[model samples]
Target chain A: GAGVSQSPSNKVTEKGKDVELRCDPISGHTALYWYRQSLGQGLEFLIYFQGNSAPDKSGLPSDRFSAERTGGSVSTLTIQRTQQEDSAVYLCASSLARWDTEAFFGQGTRLTVV
Target chain B: AQRVTQPEKLLSVFKGAPVELKCNYSYSGSPELFWYVQYSRQRLQLLLRHISRESIKGFTADLNKGETSFHLKKPFAQEEDSAMYYCALSKAAGNKLTFGGGTRVLVKP
Candidate 1:
């Protein structure tokens, strides 16, 4: 694809419901990242995947938050039993490589936990 | 643990006025820094990176290792420069990028 793509630009789910956000990174990109953008919290790193290495999950806020990148090209962020505080924009970015390269961001998935 | 700090939450300046967005980071190892901008209704994009030592859209940022800061600056701001700016840091070996609490710049006409 020309740029990073995310599915369901806006998602509205009831509290306690599980929601899944998807990201399709640029072709041939080896690095992918997920971030959460909230009102005052700014961009919070959620997870990062580089090639075939073990993903760095240090940023996942809780057990309910999980992500998986399949085939190193597409990724999914799953929020289980979502809470009101989970309402925020989920962003995905991809870069040619992890070092000294630019990361191209997606339009972002706006999740609204009602 | 690595961290990035953006002191200002909001900065308002008149068009053609000089503008600077302060950024500071705390990292134990060598750091790579970058500036990203997001205009209204647009996706976030890279404005510049310290390694490149280049300017984009009339904006430049200098990495001061002594102060652990990478501040974005522009001599004359333009209305189009109004956007949300973020400062990010990553390890030299390319770890996950850590971002600061973005600063919103509103360039008045």
Candidate 2:
């Protein structure tokens, strides 16, 4: 697919359990970003990965949240000890370059924490 | 700090009517603004960027530095154009983006 791809379109997990969300960005894109959208709220920046560079994790809310981009293509966002507040739509986006360019987004993973 | 704001949570208009979705941003440096749209059951996609200064699907947004706004406009609203629209801003020196709460436009025939 030409667009950014995300797995587990929907997930239901209990509190204290851990969950991992995956993202497959568009081919040849060098920059990827992760954001979370809570109900009726705006997108909250989570992390950013540039090709072969140190990721910008400033947006990450807590230590339990971590992400990695392997081979500069696919990325995963892991949340440990999931709390009820963790429920939201996790969105992944990729751009051909960096901030100066436009980005393509995926359908997003809707995680529901109970 | 960079911030984007969309005052209207929802806007409704009749088909063929002119429509405008307001977007405002607060950034200290050069501003990079973008308008993204998400149709029903679809992923959010870029609609237009202020730098391009191009009209997409008859939609155009003018970057107002003085007003600190980038309002999207279309001569005639179409049913297919109804979607959730978000306004975002990224400061020139940063990779992080600030997004607004989003505005949903509904076009009725």
Q: Which candidate is the best by DockQ?
A: 1
> Model 1 misses residue B26 by how many Å?
1.1
For model 2, the docking class works out as medium
lDDT of 2: 0.91
Model 2 per-residue lDDT at A5: 92
lDDT by residue for model 2 over A1-114, one digit each (tens)?
778999999999999999999999999998899999888777788998888779999899999999999999999999999999999999999986656688889999999999
Candidate 2 Cα misplacement greater than 4 A, ranges: none
Candidate 1, residues A1-114, lDDT tens digits: the string is 899999999999999999999999999999999999997668999999999989999999999999999988999999999999999999999987757778999999999999
For candidate 1, give the lDDT of residue A3: 94
User: DockQ score of candidate 1?
Assistant: 0.74
Chain A TM-score, each candidate: 0.97, 0.97
Q: What is the alpha-carbon interface RMSD for each candidate?
A: 1.4, 1.7
